[model samples]
Target: MVSIVQTGVANRASVIAAFERCGVEATRAATAGDIEAAPFLVLPGVGSFGAGMEALRAAGLVDALRVRIEAGGPTLAICLGMQLLCASSEESPGVEGLGVIDAMVEALSQPARPRFGWNRVVPEFGCEVITEGFAYYANSFGVCERPAGWACAMSALEAPFVGAMRRGAVVACQFHPELSGPWGLKLLQRWMAMGVAAC
Candidate 1:
């Protein structure tokens, strides 16, 4: 399966290596058609809401992604990538998203701002995740009121924000799994395994 590193912080190399380590053939997205052709597409980022959205729009990938998702292609969105899957973001008011999942990307409201470092990535309903440790996080925004059947990897920030959510073939996260090491790699493998089973 091929993956697209949508943004600069896409962690494209690490993801490719991780999938390769798992015996999966992964390729970087080179064009809009590349994204559409990809059986599995990845949207990763580590920037602000406005900047991230601008990048997608400038790249002309937003609508392409929507079309692919509508067609039922598997997609994995990490960090800001996951945020872009939502309809919109209050973090960057008026900035549009792919709207694949019924959710919104909002910022953390904390007196002590600039939250960082590894945080827990456990399932919202007590289900086990790739591991029981913190995943890498650089952003302060997360998805809210996620749709049912979507697994949430929540973190303890100003509130228990939605760190990750998975629905259908689309798996999204607010953390950087590539930087999270083996456990994160395993999660990608799990997604690939899910796609294989889906086929």
Candidate 2:
């Protein structure tokens, strides 16, 4: 089953609904025990890095998530959840991340405080599963470094920033797929398929 980690401050309900719409069974995991029992995991978030990370820690899910990933579990992280996977975020400096991806989250160079609309993203390499299209983003912070190859996807604001990233069984996106309409739903479907394949 796919477990959506309810950090208590994230948009867990919508994410769970999105997976269900894609014909995937998803459950909201309120505790570490629930998280540990899930085969596939989804970490959905909103707000600042420190708040998000602290919520996970308070829920006793930080270590559990690391353990799960170490075991090669399929995981998907959205929006702030994606940022939390990095080493640290400028939005919350000195706050260590889950360190799943050796990258840093930084404020968007764009003049806009929060990008709240549809934006086009292109696959840097030959990323087949994550198709290039217009996806909705609603954030002020983005991945500081650009994606090197197929392992990441790029989107434009003032310049290119990491929009989507993947490493092994883990895939993350800065945009809200649950609220991105059709394109987002398609992306989630592809991600769900990948999660199933990983399982």
lDDT computed for candidate 1: 0.73
lDDT of 1 by residue, 60-163 (tens): 78778888776667878877788888888877888777777777766676432456788887675533444467788887667656555566766777567887
Give the lowest summed-lDDT range of ten residues in model 1: 124-133
**Reference-based lDDT, each prediction:** 0.73, 0.80
Residue-level lDDT tens digits of model 2 in 98-162: 98777888888544377799898777554556688888899999885854432888888887888
Clashing pairs in 1: 119-134
State each candidate's clash count.
Answer: 1, 0
Alpha carbon RMSD to native, model 2: 2.1
Best by TM-score: 2
Q: How far is candidate 1 from the true structure (C-alpha RMSD, Å)?
A: 2.6
Which residues of candidate 2, in runs, are more than 4 Å off? 110-112, 147-150
Top candidate, metric lDDT? 2
| Shift of residue 127 alpha carbon in model 2, Å | 3.2
